[model samples]
Target: MARRRNPFDIFSDFEEMFEEMLREFEKMGPGEHISGPFFYGFSINQRPGEEPEIREFGNIRPERGRIEIGERKPLVDVFDTDKTVQIVAEMPGIEKEDVELNVEGRELEIKASRGDRKYHEFVELPADVDIDTARASYKNGVLDITLNKVEKNKGRKRINVE
Candidate 1:
């Protein structure tokens, strides 16, 4: 019989690898400072009849045996309804005034930065939304946005060329 593999083993392996990388950083000269506000996380979503979706968020990335830090991508969820589209994002330790949003057609860009925390995410809306009707609220590290969906064209329009 074949041996059964343990799912949690991967997490332990990841921790060991991460520690090794940190030790490599310690090898730098004493004058070098290794400070960090690093963030890394992931989310798994499984719908009723669809394949599981895995999403990675945060500012940490391993490239060519080195860790790269950049703007964190907050975990976001988009809900589409017949009349509206709602989006929720998790952005901790950020103020409402620091958040900036831009919407054009079916795309929405969210950006926020304060002190050492910075977040940026581009969301592709499921349907057309009325930019003027968008509403947003933030509280306790969560940002919620809602937009009214544009009505679909009833029928095809005939265009005449001169």
Candidate 2:
């Protein structure tokens, strides 16, 4: 007579199998790059009454110095109002003296450097602004810039119909 197995035994079996799979993945050679938490090159495409197709979908071999998919760009906000244009940027770990701002025509350029880290960004204004009237302030890793818009003359010109 054979001994009966408990239904919960299947869960333990799955746990052991998962642990073994993880161990095998950890033994990957140095040439292999692990980009995700779970199994690599594992994908399943399924359809009703059709066999599932397994395929590899992501970058398995990445080159050195190449930007990763998870890389992030700096956060910036530009607000355009009737009288002024305001720009805000987040630059942590840098002092006010490390930052430089330049405005030419309709463009605003920002540059900052601190030790080994450097940042540069260019923003285009919606309307022509008075660069001389631009005001900027930096506080607690946040930089705020305000530019007064060039005033337009409201005088109407009467054009004779040709």
Candidate 3:
């Protein structure tokens, strides 16, 4: 003789599993927008013996009437010429008064918040610069920052290791 399984028992097991899955998804938080299994508009590249690198191209949620959860990091590019360092950043839908910039040592920090959008980013400069001499301008949702390089002798100190 063989043992028989009840169909109702099998259905009950499936229902429990589905409910568990839903509970886990709810933990991600209410009003959390996710387009798919992975964050939309992002790509990942994996190489042998190396960690995966993720790059985000844009936001997938509807641009209008979307509520963001936390601070977003804006895309920025830093470059240097012979005498100056330049930083260009894209911050859409932000006003001039909503943006704040700070430079300490070789690090540059940018923060902006307006309406329902927030952005923050930190950049390490290629060379030491005079923060007081930095000039910045924002127009049409873009920010351009320029800093003059400090003289090498004045920018570095020789520490006597005792």
* CA lDDT scores, all candidates in order: 0.86, 0.67, 0.72
lDDT of 1 by residue, 57-146 (tens): 888755567776788999999898999999999999999999999998789999999998999999999999999888999999999999
Which of 2 and 3 is ahead in lDDT?
3
Superposing every Cα of model 2 onto the true structure, what RMSD results? 15.4
Minimal lDDT window, size 10, model 2: 65-74
Ranking by TM-score: 1, 3, 2
lDDT of 2 by residue, 1-162 (tens): 976668745344444444654665577799986453222233355667987544322222122423223211235667889999999877676899988999999998888877644556677788899988889998998889999999998889988998
RMSD of 1: 4.4
Q: How many clashes in each structure?
A: 0, 0, 0
Candidate 3 lDDT = 0.72
Superposition error at 156 for model 1 (Å): 8.1
User: Clashes in model 3: which pairs?
Assistant: none
Prediction RMSDs, each to the true structure? 4.4, 15.4, 12.5
